[model samples]
Target: MAQSIYLGLMSGTSFDGVDGVAVQFVPGQPLQVLAASARSFEPALREALFALQTPGHNEIEREAQIANQLAHDYALTTNELLQQAALKPSQVQALGVHGQTIRHQPTLGYTRQINNPARLAELTSIDVVADFRSRDIAAGGQGAPLVCAFHAVQFGAPDETRVICNIGGISNITILAAEETTGGFDCGPGNALLDYWANLHLGTPYDTNGCFALSGKVNENLLHTLLAGHYFALPPPKSTGRELFNSAWLNIRLEKFDTLPPQDVQATLTALTAHSIARAIAQFASRCQAIYVCGGGARNPALMQMLGAALSTAGLAHATLSTTDTLGVPAQQVEACAFAWLAMRCVTRAPGNLPSVTGAAGPRVLGALYPR
Candidate 1:
């Protein structure tokens, strides 16, 4: 039997690194994750990318250089995947590379993922699929939480309603109900603010195991203020990123409570993620019997514990809380695997965005290809 192989690369809102997976998709069969690899961005490149997240002088040239750097890093990870899988580039159908997102404003009718796909193709000698969001935005959709479609196919169960919560820099959810339409939307800030506070105070890229959060008490007033943001009240078919939840946004809010301990703020931010997600599920997916978490936040025991408590407080105590590993996909790899599945759909000229989740005008074939 022939193998339908594709590679997916993702550098999500966390700006931590690139995660790549080489997967085989057999129709009516479980996906075979042949190999997985991740590479942290060089400190300089990571800082440059983070700086690009906001407006700056001489932005155009800076962005170009960073994009090229990202492509080189992506190629390095691609090489690692090929080595691990022992498969030539020609054997893979395409590379679904979600370039780092510097801006995602679906309301503005444009979203930018900085990447030089042509360079990636040149370096790897493989067909590359990039820009998977703009088409949906053109169709009047959120152009995000695109993983919901993949989640449905990869994790849905016939006997139960399941919710897949991906907690990257921004948290999002996908609802899979038996015989019901799959739906999802971004809940709110995930690890973005948590990581920012950790880096700012603890001198770490992230709060390992959420020990910092667990060490402090959540400031209820701070949590209340964080939840009062307009984004949380807005209905679904929506998405957000650093654009609305960056350091400036947090610092401004923090101005009101300088006396609060940094660890306390971190604890509140963690709760903010949990409570907002719980609210989304309670209001939108209250019927979901299982909540499977994936992404960096899943590894945070403190955040996980808070999420479970929040759900219970939201009247979903019966719902189970666990990571996607129970479903055979590691928590951190779900988004990367999703892009791989999307690349397969793109190469086959099939629709990849779900109108139910992204609220597109209709199904659209996502991604632009740069053929090797």
Candidate 2:
């Protein structure tokens, strides 16, 4: 039998880097993550991406240039993963690439996740499937938090409910109940504010293990003020990104506290993530027996502790805290692995989006294919 391998590439909202994974799927067997590799976007590339996120003059040309640069970087990451797995490109069936999402406005009827799938296909010598969100939006859905299907596939348990909380640039959650429809949505900022505040104060991309936040005390006043926003109260079947929860949003909130401690603000942001997520889980998955966190947040011991405490505070003391690693997939690898599985679904012409999760008109096969 042939090796059923596929490649998945993801550069989340953090604008940090690209995560690549080569996975092997076998019928009636466990998922085989053959290899995984990551590469940070160049500083210049990161700056360009951040700039292009909003709007500017001459953006058309600059956006194209940046897209080209991204293709080059993505190609490098893909080749590295292939090398790590000691496999050739021809052996891999297809590559699923979640390009950099510069603007995500589902309400406005469009969301742009930029990537040159044609170029990626040419460079990698493999079939490519990208642009997976537009169809869902056209079908009147949020076209986001697309991992719920993957969460159901990978984490669903027959006896107990499971929640997959992925804290990336923005945090999202997936509920897996054996008898109910799987669903998820973006809760709010995850590492976005934490990373921004850290870079502002420490000149680092992110606070290492949330150390800076751990050193500070949570300011209840700021926490309450931040929590007062209607975003959290609007309920699920919703999604968000840097567009609403970026530095500008933070500055507007910070304006009221003229003399607040910077580290305290970071602590409050972390608390906000914890509280909002805990609240969502409590409301949506009250019967959940386990909460498995993934993505970059899993690496932050301080944030994890806060999340556990918040869950206990929400009367979910019976719930256990764990990472996706405990279930045979590493935290960082889950998203990439999800894309790989999604690509497999695409080629198989199987529906990928879950209507209960995205609120789309109905199930549809996501992503456009770029043949090799």
Instruction: Summarize candidate 1's per-residue lDDT along 1-372 as a digit string, tens digits.
Output: 346999999999999999999999998987879999989988898899888888899999999999999999999999999999999998999999999999998998999999999999999999999999999999999999899999999999999999999999999999999999999999999999999999999999999999999999999998898999999999988999999998988898889999998899989999999999999999999888999999999999999999999999999999999999999999978999999999999999899999999999999999999999
Displacement of the residue 337 alpha carbon in candidate 1, Å:
0.6
Which portions of model 1 show Cα errors greater than 4 Å?
none
Write down the lDDT of every candidate, Cα atoms only: 0.94, 0.91
TM-score for all models, in order of appearance = 0.98, 0.98
lDDT (tens digit, per residue) of candidate 2 on 104-202: 999999999888889989998999999988899999999998998988888888998899999999999999988888879998989999999999999
Residue pairs in clash, model 2: none
lDDT of 1 at 14: 96
Backbone collision tally, model 1? 0
Best candidate, lDDT: 1
Model 1 score (lDDT): 0.94
